[model samples]
Target: MKDHTGKPVYFDEEFREISLMLLKAKTRWQIDQLKQYADEAIIFIDEPILSALGSSSYLGVSETETARLLKELIDVIKNEGGISGIHCCGNADWPMAIKCGPDIINFDAYDYAGTLALYPEEFRGFLEKGGYLAWGIVPTSEAIAGENPESIRKRFEQGVEKLSLHIPKDLILSNIMLTPSCGTGTRTVEETIKVFQLLMRLKEEYA
Candidate 1:
C-alpha cells in the first residue's frame, strides 16, 4: 500500500495483485447484479483498486490497463442496458474517464469549473453525444459547509454559462445533472441533509 506522499508504507505485491483481481471480479459482479434490478437506470463501477490514494487526487491505470479495464466494464454496462458513470471528486484524468466509455462523467465542476470550460472542443463533443455531465455543485468541504442553495445554484449557473458557450443550451440542459462536490461521509449530518436539499432545489429551479 502507498500513501498520498507516494511512499510505500506497506509492501505486499502478491496481496495487492490478488486484491486487484478481487476488485475487478466484484465490479463485474455488481455490473451483472445491477442489471438484474429493474429499477436501476445507472451502474457506477467504483474502480478504486489502483486509487488507494485519495479520491480527488490524480490517479488512474496506465494507458494499456485503462483501455483494457474500461473496455471490459463498458461492455458489461452496455450489455446490461444501463448508463455507466464514474465519480471522482478529487482531481483526476478527465480524458481517461471519457475514454472509459461511461455515459456520464461525474466530476466536481463547482470547484474546477474553469478547467473543464477551457476544453470546449472536447466538452462539446462529449455533450453532442447522449453523454451526461453530472456536476457536483454542492459544497461539502468543511471549510465551506455553510453554503446554501442559492450560493450553490449560482455556482452551477455560472458553470452552465461557460459550458453553454461551447455547447447548445438544450443539449446542456438535457444532459446536466447536479450533485455534491463529494460524498457526505466526511461531513456533519446537518451539512449532509442540507446538501441533498440544496441539490433538489437547484434541480427543480433549473430544470
Candidate 2:
C-alpha cells in the first residue's frame, strides 16, 4: 500500500477493495490538515480495509507490506506526539494489527470477542507493550433491544474472561475502553443518545 491513491479503486477475491497504500507523505499532509480542527494528541486512523487483509480478493497483498503501510500512518501520528489508534470494527487479522505497533486497536468486541480470543499470545504481547484495547462491546444495532448497562456489563465480563485467560484480569480492565460495535450511521438521534447513555452508565459501573 503506497500513498498514490489514484483514479479508480481495485478489488480482491471476496470483492473487497485493497487498492490504496496510504503513503507516509499523504498521511502527514492529511493529518496536518486535521490537526487544525481536532485534538492532534490522539489521532485515530479508521481503515475498514484492514479487515480485508487476508481475504481472497487481497491475496496478492503481502502482510508485511500491509503492516508497513499501517506503520507509515502510525509514525505520522507518533511524530506529531499523538497516540495512533486504528479501528477495524470487524473480525479481521488481529496479529497484523499488533505487528503494526499501534497505540490502540479498536474492534467490534460485541460480536467478535471470540475472534480475538483465538490470538492470546499476540493479544498479550500487544498489551504488554502498552498497546490499549478499545473493546467495542456495546451493540449499536437492533441487538441492543434488550440490553442495558447492567446486561452489557455481564456480556463484557464473559468476553473478557476469554482474554483474561492469557492476561491478568486487572491488566485487561485497566487498559480497556468501551465503545459501540460501530457508528450509528442509520440510527435515529434518540437511539444514538441511548448508546452514549449506556456507555456512561457502564463506565460508572466499571469505574
Candidate 3:
C-alpha cells in the first residue's frame, strides 16, 4: 500500500492515499485469513515503517495519528475474531503501538528491550488488560551463530524482569510468546533451523 503508485509514499508528505489503500487491502487480507484459518489464525499486520514514527522522516506525522492508522488496520483483524499481532522489531515508538491496542506487541527484545522498559506504566496497563507480548528473544543477526539456548533464555529472563516492573511476572509470562528478534528472510536456511531448535529446547527446559 505504501508503494501503490510505484514509488514510496513518504509519511511526512501526502500519505492519505497510501493510508486508505493500505486499510482496504489490510481488511481484505483479514477477511481472507478468516475464510482460510476460520478464527484459529493470529493475523499479523507487518508495518516495519511504524518503527520510524518518531524519526525526522515522519516528523509531520503525529503519534496520535499513527495510533489511529494502526487501529484502523488492527480493527479489521479483531472484528473477525482473530488475534491481531503488530510487529515493529526495531526500536519504535512503543507507546503508539500499545495505544493501537494490538493483542500482541512484537519488538526486538534481544537488543531493544530496554527501550520498552521506559514505558513501565503504559506497558503495565496493556499487560493488565490481558494484552500479549511477543518477545523477540532469539537473535536474527549474525550473532545467531554465537548464541546458544542458555544465553537466549538468560536474555529473555532479563527482559521479562525489566518489563515486569509494574506488572506481575506470572501475568507477563502467561501472555508471552518467544520469537526471533526479527524475520528470518535474510538468514541462511541452516541458521534459521538452528534458531528454531534453540528456542524449542529452551521452551522444553522452561516447560
Candidate 4:
C-alpha cells in the first residue's frame, strides 16, 4: 500500500503505477545524494516485496514476478558497488530472497533460529551462494533493552550451536552478522543509544 522506505511519502492507490525497480532506483539516487554529507557506511535498500507478496493487496502478483523485480534491483545496486541488505522481520520468502541476490538476509534469528537451522538444504545453498545471515539477536524494546551483553552473547552462541548442525563454526562466523531484533524507532532514544553502546562493547570483546 505505502512505500516502506522510511520516507515522508504518503502514496495514494494511484501510486501503484510505479514498479519496484523504479522505486529502488529513486531511493538509490537519494542515498547517493546523502552520501556527500554522511560518514562512509554500507548501504542497504529495503524493498519489502516479500512482505508485500504475502499481503492480500499483492495477491494478484506471482512469486516469480516479485523475485524478478528484486533481482533487477539487486543487480543495479551490485553494479554500483554497494553492499545490499533486505530486511524481512516477519515471515519471508527466504528461498526467493536468496535467489534475488541480497548480500545480507536480515531476519529474526533470536526467535526463529531453528527454522533456518533445520532447513539444511536451503541454508547450505544460501551459504554456498555467498549470502550472509544478519541475525537479529539484540532486543530493541525498552523492556528487553536492559539485557546484558553476556546474555545476548550467550543467546548468539546458542544460535550458533543450532546452526552448526548445517554449517561449521568457522563458516558460520565468517557469514554471521549480529543485529538488533528490530529497529529501535519504537523505543526511546535512550534505549537506542544503549543498544549501540552494548554492540560496541561486544565488538571490543569479540574482535
Candidate 5:
C-alpha cells in the first residue's frame, strides 16, 4: 500500500485477501443458516481494526476503499435477506462507517458514545433511513462490577441525550438496541453472566 505521499506503507495484502475470503465464507454460512433454520438473521461484521483507520499506525489506509469493502459485504448480506450490522468496539470515523449503509451500527456506547455524536449529520441521515443503533452500554471489562442496571440505563440515556441535539430524542430512543461494550471472551464466566444479567435488567427497566 502507498500513502498519499506515494510512499510505500506496510500492509500485508495477502493476509487481507485471506481475511476477506474467510469473512465472505462465514457470512455465506450464516445466510444459509438463516435460510435453513430461522426466519431472520442479523449478522454483525466485527471490525475492531476500523478504530485504527486514521491513526498514525495506519495512515495509508484508504477510507474510500475501506468503505467499499465494507459495503460490498454488507450488500451481500442484505441482498440475501439478512440484516447486516457493523460492530466497532472503539472510536472510529463515524461518518465513514455510517456511509457504508449497514442496517445497524454497533458501537461501544459505554466509552465512546460521545465520539459518534461528533458526526450529527451522518447519524441523522442514517436514522432517518430506518437504520438502527446497537448501543453497547453494558461494559464487558472489570468496570461491569461497578455498574448496576440503573447506572447503565442512566449512561445510555446520557448518550441518547447527546445525539438528540441533532436528531429527535424519540427517534433515537426507539431505534436503539442494547449490547455489551464488546464480546465477553476475555471475561470470566461469572463476569460474563453478570454482564448479561445486567443487560436484561436494564432492558426490562428502561427499554
Candidate 6:
C-alpha cells in the first residue's frame, strides 16, 4: 500500500510480527495501569484505522481478522475486570464493530451519529446486552469555533431521537456517554481548553 505521500508501505511478515508485539506490549501496559490506578478501568482501543478498513487502499485487509484482533483485546480487558471500548473516528462497518463484543462503542457522533443509527437492530442488541455508547458530540476541529454546549446538546438529542425509533429511548439514554469527536492533540491549546470546557458544561447539564 501507499501512504498519503504515495510512499510504498508494506504489511509484510516482519511488519505483522512487529505490529502484534506492539499490540501485546500496549495491552500489558494498559492492564498494569488498570491494576495500579483504579478498581475498574475504562480502556478505549482507539482504532481510527477502522475508518479506512473498507476503503480501496485497505481492500486486502480481512474484516474477520480485524474483528478477531479487536475481540482478542476486548476479551483480555474484560477478563482483567476492565471496561473495554472501541473508538472509530469515522464511519465503518458498525455491525462488525458491534460483533467484536466491546463493552462500549465510541464514534464521532458530531458528524457520523447517523452512520451508527443505520444499524438499529445491531445497536439495540448491543445495548440490550449492557453495552454503552460513547457519543463523541464535541467537535475537535475548527468546527468547534461555531459550536456551544446548547448546540451540541441539541445535536445529541437529535441523534438519540433517531436511534429511539427502533431502540427504547430509555435504554439508549441510560447507557450513553459523551466525548470529543476525536483526540484534540492536533488542536491549539486554546481550542483544546474550549473543547473540555464545552464538554464539562454539557456533562453538568446532563448530570
How badly does each model clash, as a count of residue pairs?
2, 5, 0, 0, 0, 0
C-alpha lDDT of residue 14 in model 6: 61
Residue pairs in steric clash, candidate 3? none
What lDDT score is found at residue 172 in candidate 5? 90
Better of 1 and 4 by TM-score: 4
Worst 10 residues of 3 by lDDT: 4-13
Tell me the tens digit of each residue's lDDT in model 2 across 127-189: 877889998888888787768878888888899998888789888888988888788887788
Model 4 gets an lDDT of 0.71
Stretches of model 2 off by over 4 angstroms after superposition:
1-40
lDDT, candidate 6, at 54:
76
lDDT of 3 by residue, 1-207 (tens): 356566545453457756666776867665776677464568777778887876888677677766777787787778766678888878787777888889998888899988877887888888889898888888889999999978988888998888778678898888888878888989999999988998798788767
TM-score list, all predictions: 0.77, 0.82, 0.86, 0.79, 0.89, 0.90
Ranking by TM-score: 6, 5, 3, 2, 4, 1
Better of 4 and 6 by lDDT: 6
Best by TM-score: 6
lDDT of 6 by residue, 26-90 (tens): 87678777688788888899988898987898888789878987888888778778889999989
Error of 3 at 17 (Å): 3.8
Off by over 4 Å in 6: 1-10, 13-18
- Residues 1-207 of candidate 5 have per-residue lDDT tens digits of 455676543355665666667777788888997777777789998989899998898788888879978988998888888999999999887788888889999999999999877888888889889999999999998898899878988998898888888889988987889899999999999999999998999889764
RMSD in Å for model 1: 4.7
Model 1 spans > 4 angstroms off:
1-21, 31-37, 46-61
List the candidate numbers ranked by lDDT, top first.
5, 6, 3, 2, 4, 1
